[model samples]
Target: MEIDDLTPAETRVWRAFATGTPVDFRATDDEDPSDGGAWGAERTVRAHVLRALLLDGPRAEGEVPALNLAGVRVTGVLELQYATVDHPLRLRHCHFEDVPRLYGARLREVNLSESVLPGLISHAVRVEGVLRLTRARFAGMVRLGGAEVTGSLYLESTRIQAPDTEGPVLQLNQAVLGADLWAPGLVARGEVRLDGARVAGTVNLTDAVLDRPGGTALKAETLAAESDVLLRDAEVLGRLELRGARIPGRLDLSHARLANPGGTALRASSCVIGELWLRQGPMVEGVLNLRRTQVDVLFLEPEVVPAWVQLNDLTYTSLIPHEPAERRLPMLEKGDSYLPFVYEQLTASYRRIGDDDAARSVQLAKQRRYRRTLPWYGRLWGHLQDVTVGYGFRPLRAGGWLLSLLAVGSAAYGLHHPPPLKPAESPDFNPVFYTLDLLLPVISFGQENAFAPEGGYQTLAYVLIITGWILATTVIAGLTRTVSRQ
Candidate 1:
């Protein structure tokens, strides 16, 4: 592995490293560059081995030019396990033509800036310091399972290609990230799985476009974080599942487009956050399932009125729901009761969009579904009373008395004139006499003879008159008592 005894290609690689010059390797037909004479075609192989060894050792104290490992495709695994370089290890403008394996490699402080890694497998890799990969592109699968990164993981302006079998483009299961996981302007053409990953800081995916038509764009479970999971302005072409993810701060999904047609579940079950907002978006398909998800402040912003169709047990300032527009208004009005406030703030929302009817229907359906929830007395007696009061049977009873009064008046008027007889042919032809003879008797006994003839009707007339008088007197007495109490 000495420099002088190395081949011409190896000498070239060694010269490049010594002079701090960029090493460029030409692409060959064979997958393994070592198999052909291509090994000597690029640079010193001994220098690469030396550089790898130095990276695994302690960092040099003085400032030096960043080690550029650009475009040197390794035939076998690029083993840089336990690397602790002080100077930023630059892999700028490099291309990994084949799948590169870097298992257990410790990148203390590295910058893979603007690199193209088509296929990469860095399982159990520990990044102690910052790992900046700004403007990098991944054409194939990238796995980083069980990785522990203390510093910020930057992936700005990166593009990850889709997998062949509708799998995730980037998988980071069981990884412990300390600083912010920033992926601004990053685009993923496949699913991005971070299941069981713990982020200490914010997991920002702002302005990122994720296209996963066959599956979910982001799937993270038990993702506990202090700061907000900011997905603001991020576009997901498929489902975004955050099942069992807990955030101490807000889960901001505002101004984001999430379109998943396969009935994909956007579950955030058992999650605890300050707020979970999906507002400010024009469209969001699939259910925004939040079963058992707890939020300190649930903001339904005014501009997001039509975004949500249904909600369940989402606690807010009030247990009642509010119209997005009216939520900002004062809760109390002049001389208004709390019931009206609750009704207006909560029930009015459903009533405005006709959802109240649907909610009532759902409640009724639930009553039928879980009949045992109610006691027998409540189900039978209380429910029947509710129906009766709702239909206003008391008002119908009042109308019955009015109908009877009108019937007695009409019958008595008919009996006095007999249709064929005229006023001029009447016996006395006097109005006062007619009034005393006809009107007084009719008023007194009209209830009995109102619908019958002379003899038998007279007997019935006395009974009906007495009964009618008694009913009228009782009604008047009840009204008096009610008025006195008031």
Candidate 2:
């Protein structure tokens, strides 16, 4: 391992290291000097280049390093652990045919820009300082689980290819970051898992595109952020779960395309935030489950209307199986101004479930909530006062005009035909038929007791007078007085 007894190329590489100059394979325009003739011949020059960096000490600053392994064939593990670099580490146009390990490596103030890292494994990679990947592309699978970073982690315009499984393309499970995590314009062909990851600052995924199948586009849980969890204009082909995450500031999913097979659930249970905006892209296929999620000020805080109002637009085709009604109502109620919208959506959902009563109840509750805001002639206007003293009560209104017409017709018939007088011997009036007799007019064609002609005419005259008085009273009452209490 002595520098003096090494080969000429190795001596030159050592000299470049000592002199703080650039050490790149492309600089020499030949294969790495470490790849001897007796060792594996098919081994790639890039492998030797990586081996030199791993085994070597700290690299000097301002080194124009480049490792172009565009088509190099490799079959073994490429370890680059504990390597410190002050300059940018360029692996542009490189292709890893197999999985490569770079675990526990400290990439401090380095740039891996415009590189293609296929199947790169960086498990437990402690990035203490800033690591920039402006336009790097990842072809196969990549794992960044349990990685911790103290500085800003920038991945702007990065592309991550989808893996064959239903899992995420880039898994950042249980990772912790001390600074802001920026990934604007980041495109992922597969899902992204950041479950239990904690970021002290904002977790920005603005303009990021995440495309996947029926699986979730982002599966993050317990993500505690001090600032906003910004996902503005981020397109998610599958569900986006922020379940059990705590966001101190706003949770902005504005203008994001969130597509789920049935629906998407942005469950942020037990989390506190200022606002939750589902206002941008509301054409969600499923319910936006915010079960037990707590918001401080505003919920369903939409930036615009009509275009971003699809929480209740789900049809019967999107209905799922039965869930507990009590449990579901709270989730729908968590959003502030969107409570009405949520209730409306839930009503539709309940209707799809064949629970019409529940749906009606939800509608009634909404009406009651905004009853005071209604016009003076509205149905709920003065509802409470009307209930207290029986004001504005109208049973006839319920029966409509048909009952009134019937009452009028009965009165007309009674006026035309007066009831007959009972015999003088019969003193008592039959109480059962008395009301009916009063209502109908009895027409007399001939006189009774013809033997007494004077008496019959006199009785007929009295009867006519009495009938006239009764008819007049009935007409006056029917016209002047109201029939029944509502």
TM-score of each model, paired residue for residue: 0.61, 0.57
Cα lDDT tens digits, model 1, 1-486, are: 466665665555445543345555545322332233233435324334535534532233442434556544434445455454444465655555456565777666666656666666777888778777787777788778888889888888888884674567888878888888888888988888888888889888999998887578888878777788988898888878787887888888889877776555366767777777767775566545654566766654544332322234433332223453234332221112222222233443444456554333332333332333567975664343223221121223434653554456446544553221443443433322322233233353222222233554344445444545544444454345335523
Local error of candidate 1 at 427, Å?
32
400 in model 2: Cα distance from truth in Å? 15
For model 2, the superposed segments whose C-alpha errors exceed 4 Å read 1-15, 19-44, 57-77, 81-98, 299-486
What is the Cα-based TM-score of model 2? 0.57
Instruction: Give the Cα lDDT of each candidate.
Output: 0.58, 0.56
User: Could you say which candidate leads in TM-score?
Assistant: 1
For this target, which candidate reaches the highest lDDT against the unseen true structure? 1
Give the 10-residue window scoring lowest on summed lDDT in candidate 2.
444-453
